[model samples]
Target: MSSTFDVMVVGLGAAGSSALYHLSKTGKKVCGIDQFVPPHAQGSSHGQSRIIRQAYHEDPLYVPFIKRAYELWEEIEKESGKQLFLKTGGLMLGNSNAGVIKGAELSARTHDIPYTYLSNQEISTRFPAFKPDNDVVGVLEENAGILFPEDCIKTHLEVAALNGAEILKNVKVTTIHTHSDVVTVGTNQGKYLANKVIIATGPWISEFIPELNLPLTVERQVLYWFKTNEPSIRLDNLPIYIWEYAPGKMFYGFPDLGDGIKVAHHHAGEPTSPDTLNRNISPEEISSMKNVISTYFNLNVEFNYGTVCMYTNTPDERFIIDYHPQHKNMIIASPCSGHGFKFASVTGKLLSQLALDEKPELDISLFSISRFSK
Candidate 1:
């Protein structure tokens, strides 16, 4: 029918929800729609917990954004009155020179963050659950911890709506056409038009931005929650841990949170589309991850459960946070390569600035879509 909203955000996940909140704060007419009710298990934002640390092991460029993200997360907590984050400290274990370990050390040094590098003997003495080899060491950033992922998304959406943003859940957008003045979006429910359009769809990004033909591969990852022998050894007592079994091959686990000791491999999975993501976790799959955890912790073997989730990865593993080259009014933000959760709050704020043609204070050149050009 007619048009509404100054901005129409396509997905209400980490990035989109932040955009909605910031835009609404500016008193702009804004609306956000998601394929499913966000904070639901259907998207990457689910799961009970996600890791949040300022010692970015990925790259030094990410340190600034991550630092800002930490601040924004606290701001969101104060505004929403939700205990969405916990600081139980975090451990990064790997070979002294390994990318994961060294990267974190470098970020900590570059940012002047408080961190300590411990040798294998030190690790065993301090954290008994770990058994790193002689050559392996760890960078312990005491501030790193966990974020209640689903609750974070919900808080952002709720605050956005409280500030006068419109949100529609369970309605999928089918098509989008942009003009010089406004953007028109067609969905299963109806049609919407707005002065600006942002497509933050996680796994479904390529479907809308076909021209980019982005090589985004969707892979299925399984999460297993193991029961601990002692309830005290669970989430409350133990800190969050990530270990690099080998370069680019890693396994991470969280403390027991009544659900069990959640463990999962990072970046090792078979390709699949979101619509066809395998929901069933095979017996062999559980065995494989269980074996990895057994090496570090004593598994009760009696109490644990597992579930499947999807990861949308780009070749370089960085995110695509740029807008359409032709349609500058449209922005795309699908950074679901696994580590996007902690940055969701800041990304939302930056994307909102981008929607209004304001440059984000942090450098997003690395995340630009043009980096994919030949």
Candidate 2:
């Protein structure tokens, strides 16, 4: 294998694949390395589905970036000849004053994104699968839906490879050294040199840049699919929904698509590490999730199966997509909390721009690493 390239992207998951694809389009000598084959179940992008919504509950600043992300997803779908996004609409359900509901409404209003406010009774009438409390309201947006994360990552890598980008899989990167004008990345397989490097290694990001002391925590999250025989719980009737059952706690779910209805908590997972994570789903965890489903939704609560994934989170739970503080040629772009998969399409483009010294189209100051120093 060649030992040099224009740019090297580490971590071939959501962001890394996308970055490689966009970088390849620049006609530069780009290469991507991954410890394991992508589109696999070991990382954050393997779940069958991930929600993509325009109403930014985390912050309204994300609205513009996600708007562009929607466009890019469509472009990739058209180019790759694969269905990437499913627009089933989405609902944010909680107390009217709750952060989830209020924050979603604020983003919609600030960005002029079309949305409908529904009362508890209205929600039950429109979507019979849901049974929110009298005080819980919903912010319904037509543009919200689900994205097949594994397919998206695979398609990105495929398209990049076809465009002449070399993708090295099952190759663990051992160390990275940045000189005055070049960066050297050492992998178990061999050493490769590049003009720049992008670190989007998800939970394993801190391992490569330990000096940053980034406030990143990897949380063990469990995703469950419950068997449902009800017709109302099917895709045609139930829109993807995020419910805030309590302050700072959330449960998001997708309608049945033959396999079953997929559900998981937004956060509130046990702290863990990538090297030593418990992949098993315990009965107590299953019962805990069933309790939430039975109380809020009108569907069968029988847990069919469960799987575990990791969420690399920062203190603010936003994202980290800035250059290394000391090494300008090295970019850090991982630990997206849990809400980043939806933005991977556009995030990749932004990272490519940063890697190539082009201006990013969106204001990403909120994701800067300097915030942690303050």
Predicted structure with the largest TM-score when compared to the true one: 2
Off by over 4 Å in 1: none
lDDT of 1 by residue, 1-374 (tens): 65577888999887788878878888898999998888788767777999999888888888888899999999989998999899988888888878889899889999998998888888877766665677878888899999998888888899999998989999999999999988989999889888899999888788998887887998888888877576445555567878887887788878877787788889788999888888998888888777776676644454378778878999888887888988998999987798888888888888888998888878898899888885
lDDT of all predictions: 0.84, 0.92
Of candidate 2, the 10-residue stretch with the lowest lDDT total is 297-306
lDDT per residue as tens, model 2, 149-236: 9899999999999999999999999999999999989999989999999999998988999998999999999999998788888888
Model 2 residue 153 CA deviation in Å: 0.2
The candidate scoring highest on lDDT is 2
Which portions of model 2 show Cα errors greater than 4 Å?
Answer: 1-3
In model 2, which residue pairs have backbone atoms overlapping below 3 Å?
none
lDDT of 2: 0.92
